[model samples]
Target: MLKFVKGHMESIEGIATYPMISLLIFFVFFALLFWWVFTASKRYVREMSELPLDENNQ
Candidate 1:
């Protein structure tokens, strides 16, 4: 089954670019997330972290 899929995929031109494009998208998404986490306000982060333990929240 793997051999058949690999053979079929190899026949398609530009299929190699698909993996590169997907990798670029994956990198960009995580980079933006890392930036957000670093730049987020400390107060907001504390509140969010405690939200689950706070029973007052409905």
Candidate 2:
């Protein structure tokens, strides 16, 4: 296990810093997506509520 870890660590040493930065970019993209979906869902629900007629109002 130690040998494997050392080997993998050595191989990844050059890219070790990049993975963290990439993860940050990934999270930022996902966060933007989540925010968009959240606001869009709110708009959708609001629009549906404003319909002229519905099962309850009838």
Candidate 3:
């Protein structure tokens, strides 16, 4: 099964670029998420963390 799939994939033109584009998208998404986590306000983080425990919201 693997051999057949690999052979079929190898016949397609521009298939190699798909993996590179997917990798770039994955890296950029995580990089932005990491940046946001670091730059987010402490107050906002604290509020979000306590949201589930806060009865007033219910």
Model 3, CA-based lDDT:
0.98
Residue 7 CA displacement from its true place in model 2, Å: 8.0
Task: Give lDDT: candidate 1, residue 24.
Answer: 100
Error of model 2, residue 18, in angstroms? 0.2
List all candidate RMSDs to the true structure.
Answer: 1.2, 6.1, 1.0
Could you give candidate 2's per-residue lDDT for residues 1-58 as a string of tens digits? 9999888888874767888999999999999999887777777877787776665656
The stretch of ten residues in a row with the least summed lDDT in candidate 2 is 49-58
Worst 10 residues of 3 by lDDT: 49-58
lDDT of each: 0.99, 0.83, 0.98
Q: Give the lDDT of residue 37 in candidate 2.
A: 73
> Alpha carbon lDDT of residue 29, candidate 1?
100
By TM-score, is 2 or 3 better? 3
Q: What lDDT does candidate 1 reach at residue 14?
A: 92
Q: Residue 34 of candidate 1: its Cα lDDT? A: 99
What residue pairs clash in candidate 2, if any at all?
none
TM-score: model 1 vs. ground truth: 0.86
